[model samples]
Target: MVCKLPAVFLLVPGIFLACTSLKPVQQLSEEARRGLGHFHKLGYNYAETCTMDCTFQKVRTFTVDRRLNCECASYQKADSVVWGLFRAMEQYWMGLSELASPGLTSYDLSAPVQSLHASEFVSLSEGEVSAIQKMAEFAVNTSTGRFRSRRILHYMKDADPHLRLLTEKLGFVLEQNLLGLLEIQQEEWYTHYKTQTINSELNAMEKEWATEKHYQLVEDAEKIRLKVVSLVAMLDLIAEKHHSLAVTAEKIGSENFRNITAALSDELKDLYVVFEQVNE
Candidate 1:
């Protein structure tokens, strides 16, 4: 059983000196009081988290507005979900680049290097297997659901060269730019790490190792981060633009929904304030 403080309301009559003939208020049992206390605590915790989340959402929305209002408004006016999808694609790519690992893989080796035979090798150890499994599971679950831009393209598969054309463009651009960065990093590593006394064979092996690692990084970045980002951004943009249009249209038809939306947005801002507090 938990102890609980009496509610302020329970003391109101005493403070007011209401000398009525009514019986004294019923006393709460220890168990009940404890339960009430726990309930209050839980409520407080939820309120705190909820307030913070709302604040963050508002701040995020506002920041986007400040920077991309023109795009938002224009895309909304066009009433094409595709614009929002495109924006989502951009956002997704940006998020991946900013938030996720670029080139390195996380894994626990299947076994120590010592465990490998003198002639045999374990390319992917146990740790590596787990990491690969996790990565694959994450991709399969989130990518198609969140990243696909079906709504943007709609049924115009024939006329919409946007998907295929952009896919190729993005692939090539990322491969050259980001992959090139990986290559340069590798070359620098070799120049700095290889020992001067190493034999020609060892030197060659070191160089090869550097190149292989660089290649793997580039490949992983493209597969995991770049691809996901591009698709997610496009989809997000599409939905956002469409949502704006719907809001605008509803506003023109009925003012009530518009006001409600406005109020909701205000509450959202309050929530964003929570995030600002955390970030600061």
Candidate 2:
């Protein structure tokens, strides 16, 4: 993308205005917004691919109901749940970004937020719960007319735990369930086609065709695997950076905090560049 964020993130008009100097907390939240968007899209596709491949792999034997039960239904439900999780996470980050922004001061601010809740998919630490609650209490106070301070400590601190919880669980799902399913499908393709290559009933052209299809499956699965691996790494990076910001919450505009956020945004941008190159 022109801004070195994922295409998913760039689709939003001005979340990361390169010309504007955003506070450390605002910058971090926006970076995370990009990361979550890109990963969520990949996860959505992975879920569908997993279910579809599993269904067709056993197409010759299972009844429609059996196929749905064995393959499609669980992943379909998982997909819906995952979508909800990502949607909530995205909104949380966007709200935080708005909450922490400098330009939002004295703006016509009503409660631009709903009551945010913790999702069932993740169990937050006691520290996380306390932190978010503190932030929420602060937000309620600030809604009277205008936010009096620019110190983003409360909001960043609030975001620290939820960000970690959400990304950690999302990465786990991508690695354990979606990636695992795709790898299994890729292996099945290899084995099935390899066997067909030697089948006495198949002519040379038939074997060649099977080999080509097998290669296509491998190539496609490899792309998904690479993307999942990249996203998992990105999740870890963002969570760790957010934790650093939370720790430095008291020193919001200090050189240390500035350095941390600058390094993070650069790293994230570099990663997105690498991602685009790979995808192309």
Candidate 3:
């Protein structure tokens, strides 16, 4: 009879095969982790920009109302303040849109997070890769559109029927922006995989081996989407607040006007929370 090989001889090759099988998955997980981090950073930048813009819009309306009604000297003061705020907000948006000096902006807000090129993830389905690419492109275009919308508001007169029309237009643009973001969040791929959690029963080896690149991408995308949803909610609140403030400027000193301003200020604070959460 032939002699049988020892158990250790069989075990060595099994271990080697297991490690070899897991190598590509390990690389994919690491790459996906880094990419997801970058996506969060980009989403944070967008939130910050939106918060700044919303605050500026509110203050601008208040200052312009004061300028329209005050004596010459007071009007000059209000105008100066409005001008200063406008310039600051404009430059901030430009920086966020990646149109300003890179040395000045701390974050690279220019491009969308790139998730599709990880070589270890070569097994990722074409549909999954396409979905990520589409989301990235939507983010870039949305940022650009927001900046343009703000620019349009910069030149609009803060008086009368014109301001009403302007605020309406502004609100519409904001609504469209929010809707676009919601569409991405509602995409089948994002919704399908967002509920999946890491398996607790998976052993360390199995955990690494079973990691799916598509799941990682979907999770990261959902994080960005949630940040965006928060931001859009805040912006929508701001738009309504500004419209109300603009429409009621004639009663600026009335009790009702004061109450509206107080409410708007509280809402603005809520908007800041979105930015703070992302930074933290």
Candidate 4:
């Protein structure tokens, strides 16, 4: 007999919530079920790769748009595994839509996406939860950048050979370019926002001093304002990024929660550091 799942099992926390315990979800067609499983695994896979490869080592801060971009798209173009995973999810969503709302015209799925983030799931099997938990832990320990040579510097190193090919082709490109882009953004915090603000204020002070014949006072004022403005910009940026990354991390946890209690604490802490740096 097929074991029936609870109706409200999708509301677990941490890595455990990633697996659905609801009967409705379990009842999905084999392809849909497989697709959902694959989709959830992608997040763990990325985390594992990050842990193994240290992919985010140099990424001090990044803009929101940059975070979503897979840099390897250009090199692998039509065959990026990460992008492919995204597409696969889209297809799964479509399949679900056809099943849930047959003959309904122009149904929007934005709510489902939001619901996924809001709900949690319990796993039917402890082993499945354990595997995912391992990946999350790996992500925490690695802090990004070790997976490259061991996993995908030349080719993907996971169990799937095709996945290895895809990762080697696309992962390599994304890891390199994304890290560079993150570095650029991190540098911009100091140069663009901090230095620019300081320089602007200093220049204004200088112009005022020249006009009033108060050269000494002007230099002193410019120096003070420059330091003050730079400090302010740095603090503001760090705070903003911290908040944003924190929220995103929460969303990830909620959407794919399986073992709620264990995953939340560490993931939240990881996000806090990331956000703190962003704010800095």
In terms of TM-score, which candidate is strongest?
2
lDDT of 3 by residue, 1-280 (tens): 2332232332343333311111221222232232222223433332333343344345435544433232245434543443343334333323323332222213332233233234443434455455445544444444444343333234221433443443344334333543343344445434333322355665666545434644664565555555555544543453454456455542323465456545655655665566456545
List the candidates' TM-scores in order: 0.21, 0.68, 0.32, 0.22
Model 2: per-residue Cα lDDT over 147-234, one tens digit each: 3223356666777788788878877887788788777777777778899899999999999999998898788777777777777777
Instruction: Tell me the tens digit of each residue's lDDT in model 4 across 1-280.
Output: 3443442332232324233122221122222333223323222223333332233333324333444444443334433555674454345434533433322222343354344334454323444444444444333323222221122212211223432243343434334443334334344433433443355556876555444543443443343333323332322232232233233332222333223322333343443444344333
Worst 10 residues of 4 by lDDT: 148-157
Higher-TM-score candidate among 3 and 4?
3
C-alpha-based local distance difference test score of model 2: 0.65
Question: Candidate 1 on 73-118: residue-level lDDT in tens?
Answer: 4323332333343343344333322322212222333353224312
Model 3 quality (TM-score): 0.32
User: Please, what is the whole-model Cα lDDT of each candidate in the order they appear?
Assistant: 0.34, 0.65, 0.40, 0.35
> Clashes per prediction?
25, 0, 0, 31
RMSD of 1: 32.6
Worst 10 residues of 1 by lDDT: 21-30
Q: How accurate is candidate 1 locally (lDDT)?
A: 0.34
Any runs in candidate 4 off by more than 4 Å, and if so which?
Answer: 1-82, 85-159, 200-280
Which regions of candidate 3 are displaced past 4 Å? 1-213
TM-score of 1: 0.21
